[model samples]
Target: MLRLLKVLILLPITAILVVFAVSNRQSAVVSLWPLPYEIATPVFFLVLAPLILGVLLGGAAAWLAGGKSRRLARERARQIRTLEKAATTLPAVLS
Candidate 1:
């Protein structure tokens, strides 16, 4: 089911990207203003670089934002383990 969903979503996007890349085959000059750096590349590359970068950066930001939540969950899990251990020992001691 998950594989089907992935295929459904990715197929159209892959098709669209293929079409875009083919349509934009012309060399585009990408220049960094201020310093002398330039490269001639395809237009799709220019679009995808920032896109991939944004995805990576956004993922990092989300992970960083969830740090506290992750820590709390870990502490809760440890607490649950300790309580369970205590409960087990209490029953043995009562017997």
Candidate 2:
């Protein structure tokens, strides 16, 4: 089921990407100032490279931001386990 869902989602996206790449086959020049370096590549590459890089960097930023919450959760889980152990060793209170 999961496989089918992924195929359904990915197939169209793959087709679109293929069409986009084919349509944007014209060469584009990329250069950086303060450096003597330049390369000619596909137009689609110029657009897609930054987009993919932004996605990776954004994901990393979000993961880093969540570290404090994850750490607190782990601390809470440890405290709960400790309390459970201590409770098991304690005498039961009468109702």
Candidate 3:
């Protein structure tokens, strides 16, 4: 199911990239170096910059969040086990 969803989401992006790559012969007006520049629209960063930055940011955030949650879960499980052991031993010790 996730694979299908991934394909569906990526299909349009793949199509757009292919279209841009193939249609790069024409130029468009763009800004560069503190001025509006005329460059090949499909050949420019408009086709790549955001994708790169988004991937980097998304990867970093996922890593950071996943690490924290995994650590918290481990700590919670350890605490639960410690409490259970203490509870089980206390009755025998008191008797």
Question: lDDT for each of the candidates?
Answer: 0.93, 0.91, 0.82
Expressed as tens digits, the lDDT of each residue in 1-95 for candidate 3 is 99999999999988987777677745565767676665556454575778889999999999997997899999999999999999999999999
Runs in model 3 deviating more than 4 A are 25-42, 76-95
Q: Find the 10 residues in a row with the least total lDDT in model 1.
A: 43-52
> Evaluated with TM-score, which candidate comes out highest?
1
lDDT of 2 by residue, 1-95 (tens): 99999999989988998898899999988887679998999999987789789989999999999999999999999999999987877766432
Q: Which of candidates 2 and 3 is the stronger one according to TM-score?
A: 2
**Candidate 3: lDDT of 30?**
70
Q: Name the regions of candidate 1 deviating beyond 4 angstroms.
A: 1-7
Spell out the clash pairs found in candidate 2.
Answer: none
* Alpha-carbon RMSD, candidate 1: 2.0
Ranking by TM-score: 1, 2, 3
